[model samples]
Each structure stands twice: as structure tokens, then as C-alpha cells.
Target: MLSEKTVKDLIDNALEERSDLFLIDLKVNPDNKISVVIDGDNGVTVEDCMFMSRGIENNLDREEVDFSLDVASSGATSPLINTRQYKKNIGRTLAVKAKPDLKFEGELTDVDEAGVTLEWKTKEPKPVGKGKITVNKQAKIMYDDILEAKVIIKF
Candidate 1:
């Protein structure tokens, strides 16, 4: 078990120190469990997870607490799932292949708790009945959902 203040402080400090790895959010659920979400650099690897886990565990252990831990990285083609993730990706181009087999690539222009706005331009003429759509940010993904995402550099 862990105290909220303690967990919050630990997460905040770690996120601050390793900002290159975006600290999306943290929560101590009602079940008294701690959950951490982190967004990493484009090339985050297994080593990154190991580093974060050790850092978090080391600090928490020092406080005389025990808990289960899990750490992971954003996949090369994972969809941006939350406002925090989308904000971190602002100004970076995102390519998303949505359901119904639509492929789109665009600059991330805005993000909110509700959804995200992408400034996408297609080389071909617009398809019939194809209108601009806003995709709500999901906290997690399922296998059936289709999406491919990556950060593209644009000034």
C-alpha cells in the first residue's frame, strides 16, 4: 500500500527528471493501486521500461511499501489515447488508419479531453460523403480498431 501524497510526489519528480519520456498521468485507484502512464521518445526501447521500473521501485521501496508494477512504451503504430498524449504530440504529424479502411496523415493541431484535431491534406480529390471527422481519444485500444501512428517532423 502507498499514500497518495507520496505516490504523487514520486511520480511528479520522476516525470520532471525524465521529461524526454512524457509523463502522461498517474493515479492511485480506489482499490489502493498505483497506475502510471508514460509516453516516451520516438525510439524508446526495452531498456527504457527497465530504467523507469527501477527508478520507481527504488524510490517506493525506500518508503517501506510493496506493490506490483508494470511499465511499457508507446508502440510505433499505437494511437494517441488521451488528451495528455495528444498534447505531447502537438506539432508532430500523425498518421492514423481508421476503421472502414481510411488512411490519413496530418499535423496535430489541437487536443482536449474530448478529442483531437488534425490538419490533414490529401493529394487526391476528396471522396464522396467524406467529411472532416474528430476522433475521441481512447484510454486504451482493442485489436479490432485500426490505427497507425508516428511523429513526423514539420516546422
Candidate 2:
């Protein structure tokens, strides 16, 4: 059986060569099928995935233990799983699904160790008038409360 630690070490070595890259997830199924998902501070490229794949394939002895490796980047629409991901996405609009059946769609204005701040405008009825007015609204959501968050891409 191929060891997960061995695979992880190879991935770490590859990341050492590229400090901007970070590991998002790693899975080693019972069949020795290894899946590695990575992300970068700036972004991931096709070359980055190839580099990571070679890093693992070149180091392993496939003859001794036949194994398969799949290296891929976190998809553009994938949910944000790391704090660094949130930091990189600052200023972008995010559709956040939070706890207690709450959802928010706003520009990610800030990111801290604990959570993020979203700012957006909504139409609200005026205090002394019949017509509605635009009002600026913002919320600070804790990381624990966030069920999922994805960058809302706009054409």
C-alpha cells in the first residue's frame, strides 16, 4: 500500500520550490488513487499542476507499487476553504451561505483571522417618505458561521 505520508512529503517538496502555492486538500483512497488539490496566492496555472504531478510521479517507484496520482487546482467556482484564499479574494464579490439558513451576497471588503466583512447596498423604505431609498449595509461574519463561500464571477 502506498503511504499517504510519502505522497504528502513529495507535495511539500514541490511547494517548497514554489512558495506561493499552498495545499488545499489531499486524498488517498484505498485503491492507492491519490488526489491532490492546490491553490496559489496569485492563482494556479496549468504548468503548476504539471509541476506538482511530476514532483510526485518522479519520486515514487511505480514498479514496486503501482499507483495513480491526480494533481489539480481548486476550481474558480469552488468554495473558499482557507483563510489565505479569502485574503486573496478581498475586493471580489462573494456569495456566502452561512449558518442558520442565512445567505449574503456582497463585496468582500475585509478579512481577519476570525472572519470577513461584506458590504453591499439595498433598497429600504424611507423613514418619512413613501418612496424607497438605497441604504448601505455591511456585516461581519465569523468563520465558524460560514457554511460555504464562493466568488461571484460577473461577466
Candidate 3:
């Protein structure tokens, strides 16, 4: 059996080489098998998994050890919008899904480790007729208040 230090060193070196392409999350199961979840810049394709698996296998083989390994992308429903996530998406808009299927379109003004600060657009202006004036309003929404959020790409 390969020691934990040996395995960690192998994984760290292998992953650090491709730091720009992917992020690795390593875990050890109760049975001592290793499970690695990889977060790629884009979605993880089969080729990526094969390449990573082969690399890890070759490294372990060199060290002469028997250990189980799994390589996979995040496969998360949504990217973790932690402080890091927010910082990465700075100056970009987002589509926020709130409770009860309510959605809000807003621009991300600030973000922290705990949550994001969203400034929802005020109400649309009404026609300047002989009737009512437009009511422009803005609201601040916390990250906890958001159910789902994704970057809104603009063409």
C-alpha cells in the first residue's frame, strides 16, 4: 500500500502541472481508496478523465502500489458561488433564481466569502402620458436569498 504522503505528493505534482486547465479535489474513502473530483475550466469530457486516470495510474505504478482511483469533473448543478466565484465573475451580470421560482436579473456589485450583493434593476419607467410616472427602484439581495445563479453572458 502506498503511504498517504506518497500519494499526495504524486497528485499535487501531477495536478500542479495543469493548474490552468483543472482543479483537483482529492478524498480518501473509508476503505482507503482514492476518489478525485476534478473541476475543469469547461465541462469534463471523457478524454480528460482518461488522461488523468492514466497519468495517476502510471505514477502509482512507478511507486509499485495498489490503490483505487477515480477522476471526474465537478458535475455540480451549479458552480460554487463562494467569494472566489464572485470575484471571478466581477463586472458580469447574473440570472438569480430566488425562492418560489421567482427570478431576478441583476448586476453583481460586491461579493464576499459569505455571499454576494446583487443590485436588482429598479422598475421600468412608465410611458410619460397624462397618467402616472415611472417608478424606478433598486433592491439589494443577499447570496442566501438566492436559490440558483449563473453568469449571464452577453454577446
Candidate 4:
């Protein structure tokens, strides 16, 4: 069985050669199956995945380790997992699930070490009018408040 540290070292070496590439997740099953998920600032391409796969394949001795590897990009619909992911997604629409049965959509305006700022619209009653008016609002959401968040694709 290949150690996780060894696998990480191999992947890290590959990423060191590439700019703007980050690892999202890495899993090594007991059956010697390794899965690696990666993302990039400009988005990851098939060639990038191939490059990472080849890098690991070349570093590890398949005959000795008896392992299977799978490397893939964190797709558009995948949930944002870290601060880097949130930062990269700035200026994009996100579907945020803050709590059970609580969800909202907003434009990600900014991200800091503590949390993210979102811009959204809400309907409020006007002071002198009978009808409600649309009001643009901004909210700061802490990282702890988020259960899941993903970029909303607009066609």
C-alpha cells in the first residue's frame, strides 16, 4: 500500500511545476485506489489532468505498489471547499445553503480570511408606496455558517 504522504509528495511535485493549480481533495482507498481532485484559477483542462496523472504514474512503481490512480478536475458544479476556491469564485453567482432548509442565491462580491461578502436583492415595502420595491443588499457570511456552496451556471 502506498502511503498518503508519498502520494501527496508526488502530486505536490507535479503541481509545483504548474502555476495556479491547487489540490481540492485526495483519497487513498484500502484497495490501493487513489483519487485526486484538482482545480485551477482559470479552470482545469483535460491536458492538466493528464499531466498530473502522468506525473504520479512516472514517480510510483506500479509493479511494486499495485495501485490504480484517477485524477480529475473539480467540475463547475462541485461545492466550494476552501478559501482559495471562494476567492477564485468572486464575481460569480453562488447557491449557498447556510443551514438545513435555509438556502439563498447571491453574487459573491468579496472574500477575506474570515468570510465572504455577497450582494443580493430583496423586496421591501416603500415608505410612501403601496407596492414593494427591489432593494439591493449586501451580507457578510461567515465560513462556519455555510453548509454547502456552489457556483450557479448562467446560460
Candidate 5:
């Protein structure tokens, strides 16, 4: 059987050559089907995926492992798992689900080592008035508190 560690090492070496890319997921089934998912700071392209696939394929010996490999980029709507992903998406809108059933939909304004800040405007009742008012709101969500986060693609 093909070892996962060996495959991981191969991928790590490949990523070293492409500093902008990062690994999102890797799976090796019992039947030796390896699936590699990758993402990039500036987003992933088909050529990037091909490069990664070749890096792995060129290193492995087909006669010895008899394995199949599939390399793909993380989809645009996929959940953001890495902090770098958040940084690249700074100006885009995101839908975030946090702890305690908290949910937020807003533009990602900032990202730091600790968390991200989302900003949006909403209509709310005025503090001492009879009518509603447009209020700007922001939320800071730490990485630990994030249950899921996805980019909101606008058409």
C-alpha cells in the first residue's frame, strides 16, 4: 500500500517550490487513490494545479506504487480553512458562522493574526426616534470561534 506520509512529503517539497500555494486537503484511499486539494494566496489557476500534479507524478514510481492521483484547486465557494485565505479575500464579502449560533454576512475589511473584521450597514430603529436609521456595524471574529466561513460570490 502507498504510504500517506510519503505522499505528504512529496507534496511539501512541491509546495516549497511554489511559495504562493498552500495545501488545503489530501486524501489517500485504501485503494491508493490520492486526492490533493490546493489553494493559493492570489487564488489558484489550472496551470498551478497542473504543476502540482506533475510535481507529484514525476517523483513517484508508477511501477512500484500503482497509485492514482487527482490534484485540484479549492473551489471559490469552499470554506476558508487557512488564515492566508482570509487575508487574500480582504475586500470580498463572506458569510461566517461562529460559536453560539452566531452568523454574519458582511464585507471582510481586515485580517490579522488573531482574527478578521467584517463591516456592513443595516437599517435599525433609532435610539430615541420613531423611524429606522442606517447603522454601520462591525464584528471581530477570532479564528477559534469560527465554525465555517465562505466567500459570497456576487453576480
Candidate 6:
């Protein structure tokens, strides 16, 4: 079986040459099938995926170990898995699900290793007025509180 570390080293080497790229997920099956998902600070293109695939292929020896590799961008629909991804998505809308069935949609404002802060609008009663008004509020969500989070596409 092909080791994940060997494949990761190759991918890391290739990524080192590209400053914007980062690894999202790497999976190696018992049958020697490797799936590598990557993302970028700006965004990843099809050409980038092709380039990474070719680079990995060039480094590995097919005769020594038979393996199939699939390199792809962590597409728009994939859930956000890391802080880098959240930082990249700053200013974009995200649908976040938290514990105890809590869910909301908001614009990602900031991100760090600890968590992310989101800005959203909600209806609240004004202190001087009897009627409710729309107010912008921010929420800080820790990584542990997030059950799932994905970018919301606006058409």
C-alpha cells in the first residue's frame, strides 16, 4: 500500500512552488487510490489541478507502486474545513449550522485559528421606537460550535 506521507510530501513540494495553494484533504484508500483536494487564497483553477497532478505523477515511480491519483480543487459546494478556507471566504455569505439545531446565514467578516466572526442582519426593537427595525449584528462562532458550514451561492 502507498503511504499517505509519501504522497503528501510530493504534494507539499508542488505546493511550495505555488504560494497561494494549500491542501484541504488527502485520502488514500487501501487499494492505493489517492484523492487530493486543494484550495487557494484567490481560488484554484482547472489548470492548477492539472499542474499538480502532473507534478505528482512525475515524482512517483509507477513500477515500484501501482496507484491512481486524483487531484482536484475543493469545489464551491464543499464544506469549509480549515481556518485558511474561512479566511479566503471573507466577505462571502456562508450558511452555518451550530449545535442544538442552530442555523443562520451571514457574511464572513474575520477568521483566525480559534474561530470566525460573522456579520448578519436581524430584526430587533429599537430602544426609542415601538416598532422593530433591521440591525446589523456580529457573532463569534468557535470551531467546536460549528456542525457544518458552506458558502452560500448567490445568483
lDDT of 2 by residue, 1-155 (tens): 88889899999999999999999999988899999999999999999999999999999998898888899999999999999999999999999999989999999999999999999999999999699999999999999999999999999
lDDT of 1 by residue, 63-115 (tens): 46557666677654566664556667778877766666766577777765555
lDDT of each: 0.63, 0.95, 0.64, 0.91, 0.95, 0.92
Query: How many clashes does each candidate structure show, in the order listed?
Result: 0, 0, 1, 0, 0, 0
RMSD values, in order shown? 8.9, 1.0, 5.5, 1.4, 0.9, 1.6
| Candidate 1 segments exceeding 4 Å error | 29-33, 76-78, 81-117, 121-155
Clashing pairs in 3: 122-137
Ranking by TM-score: 5, 2, 4, 6, 3, 1
Q: Tell me model 3's lDDT, rounded to 2 decimals.
A: 0.64
Off by over 4 Å in 5: none
For candidate 3, lDDT tens digit of each residue in 22-109?
A: 5446776655587766655545688777777776677767445557888886654455444445565656677788766677667777
TM-scores of all predicted structures: 0.50, 0.96, 0.53, 0.94, 0.97, 0.92
Q: After superposition, how far is residue 6 of candidate 4 from its true place, in Å?
A: 1.0
lDDT (C-alpha) at residue 143 in model 5 = 96
For TM-score, candidate 4 versus 5, the one ahead is 5
Top candidate (TM-score): 5
Runs of candidate 4 with Cα error greater than 4 angstroms are 99-101
Give lDDT tens digits, candidate 6, residues 1-155: 88999999999999889979999999999999999999999899999999889878898899998999999999999999978899889999999998878887999999988888889999998789599999998889989999999999999
lDDT of model 2 at position 107: 99
**In model 1, where is the ten-residue run with the lowest total lDDT?**
137-146
Local error of candidate 4 at residue 28 (angstroms): 0.5
Which of candidates 3 and 6 is the stronger one according to lDDT? 6
* Maximum-lDDT candidate: 2
Candidates 1 and 3 compared: the better one by lDDT is 3
Q: How far is candidate 5 from the true structure (C-alpha RMSD, Å)?
A: 0.9
Model 2 per-residue lDDT at 55:
93
